[model samples]
Target: MNKSTTIWGHLSAAPHRSLFLAGSFQALLTILWWSIELAGRAGLVAPPLLSGITPTWVHGFLMVYTFFPFFILGFLFTTFPNWMNGEKIRPNRYMAVCLLMVCGVILFYAGLFAGKLLISAGLLLMLTGWANAIAALFHVLLTAPAGDKRHAWVAGTAFVAGWLGLCAYALWVLTDNTDMLNFSRQAGIWFFMLPILLTVSHRMIPFFSSRVLENYVVIRPFGLLWLMVGCAVAHGILHLLDLQGYAWWADLLLAGCALYLSYVWQFFRSFHVRLLAVLHISFAWLGIAMLSFGLQGMLFWLNGGEHYWLGLAPLHMLVVGYFASMVLGMASRVTLGHGGFPLKLDHLTWLLFIAFQVVIVLRVIPDILPFAASMAPKFYLAAGGVWLSCFLLWVIKYAPIYWRARVDGKAG
Candidate 1:
């Protein structure tokens, strides 16, 4: 494949191709909306683009639901079938879903520029695409010849819950209900995003550890998974009711659980391999997030819940530290492996991964540094630039690989 290679030709050939397209689209959105947000926050832009929801909410919605789900679905669509010993997805089906999602993204942005009708339509299309993708995976689970279906089912359930949350958010847009928005956001976080991440990480990290480290213990017990899910459900419920003052309990429990799981999963031992270290360290951020949430809850409870929780700082920790890092590492591995390249993390990629951590830390400065209030805008913009740079680097490195057939001359 050369410059003449059509995106349609590539997209219709494999699930990863479509997924890479979707991810690249979302990355572009991230750069665009983030710049708009930073400019507005820094008072570099006037007549703020506040419509049905705030700009911050818009950014969150795009990142959490739009940007990440494409990557998640891409990974799951490819791997879940293999896990269940089912057939690979047909190209036509996945291509249609990808097209629908792309259109939805376009319409959603257009709605942001125009009116609510377009926004509602866009969200509906997005939700439809999401539902279709999840349903396809569920079908694989249903039809698989034979395999351990437990983890796949759990992950699928979380995706369904996430769809429900997205539905609620769309409802908020249609009806202008702030409460619905809040509920959707909370549900999406605890029920949808975190559960999927935790469940997948639980299943994969230990398995990866066992493979990478000789005699490594695979520590995923059903009980532990259940406990983690239970804690997440409780956290979501507390958030839904706006009773985050009591969230410290759930947060602390989850933190403890995360710590124990990390220990049993041999996080420290995985450091010998940089790629595995990336996964292990990314999971470590789950612990950090829970601990931060617990602390924030305690502070808020002591101060009577008067907006003293550092403004979604803990959530950002999980988003950037865990989700983004894992995505980066996993994407790197998948791209290289599938593209007929060695699954090795070269020095430059490792340095970029470290830079990603720096980006995450920079993003948190405004939340943690009260004295740095005057410099918060600079920090925010700088973080966005850094974040954009990371994705841009990924795109530059992998876009060609994604566009071409596998170097081994394989079909898919």
Candidate 2:
């Protein structure tokens, strides 16, 4: 027993291991849910078995809440201590939370198919687990001995906002109110996901750029970070109120600032290194998402709120283009670096990175198809397939590294 435990101690004794376990598990689930969505949209099956929820709602919930959080927590739990120069986190703390999340997602699925009671139970468990993870990170932030800690605080605050969003979603689920659910979803995007990602991007991208580029200097002022947060919050409120007409102004200003900051931070110069290039290009997607948001809002206002472009394209641009690409880029860097592999990008990994953009473009096709109404289903199916394929490839490439002991003979 001792021998077996010792052999696998690396996996069980590390916070990043716990997070990677959760992340890889949910990556599979992410594809599974999306595949089901593809089938439903293609009219090849009956409606989803989950009562009181539409298929699109399920997709959004799992995509935004389920798998993505695992990525964020994985990144933060591993990186936060480094950011603050704090002590390493105990593995058991994160392991328990990871288990709760995994079980909650499983129960949510089981309830969707078998018993509705499990659905509520599953959501509750998931929220509890998420809250615990946030608390753990916040504890680290509060106790850190000596670092800037400002970025960590910003991330911690966004996490709290996410917690509140989850609470609201749970309330809406219990009440069965469509409006509240919609509000919660929008909040999940603008409040939780976007803010957290942008905060991390603001902190890490410039730092990474300066590290790799010889002449690069850190030029993104902290004030711009606050501005982005303020804009993100306002964007969420406007979305919640369905006041999208005015939201474009907020988005445009935010987009302009983000682009300007990227230039000042020398993001363009970071493209010289392949690994840094991945981070730089993925970060650019944020500006693109902001641009999409502004364009969508302007089009809606011009069309007298008739939604000429419908809001789907811009949302997908953010979710798939910005969020997923960043996750892939960061995950690759962290996973390889921690596993004691070289950070250099190989052909296969580069292909995987490019495929992510293809997935984003494919997903947006349905919204932009010119008078090809009958082809929308095919486009949707293709997009989901491409997405699933990306993860499938990712799992094959990285799962072994995650499960085995680290290459360096060092404790995590």
lDDT tens string, model 1, 1-412? 5545565676566787778667866876776687876787667886456555677778888888888887888788888887888978887778777888889988988888788889989999999898888878888888898768888888899999988889988989988888878878887788888888888888888877777789876778888788888888899898777677898988888899998888888877887888788888888988998899888889889988787657657888888988888887777777777777876788878878888898778888788878766787788788888888877887887777777778887767
Candidate 1 error regions (>4 Å): 1-7, 46-52, 307-309
Q: For residues 144-223, what per-residue lDDT tens digits would candidate 2 score against the true structure?
A: 89769988888888877777877776777688777778777877888889888888988888888877789777776888
Estimate every model's Cα lDDT from 0 to 1. 0.82, 0.80
Alpha-carbon lDDT of model 2: 0.80
Question: In model 1, what are the clashing residue pairs, if there are any?
Answer: none
Q: Model 2 residue 335 lDDT?
A: 83
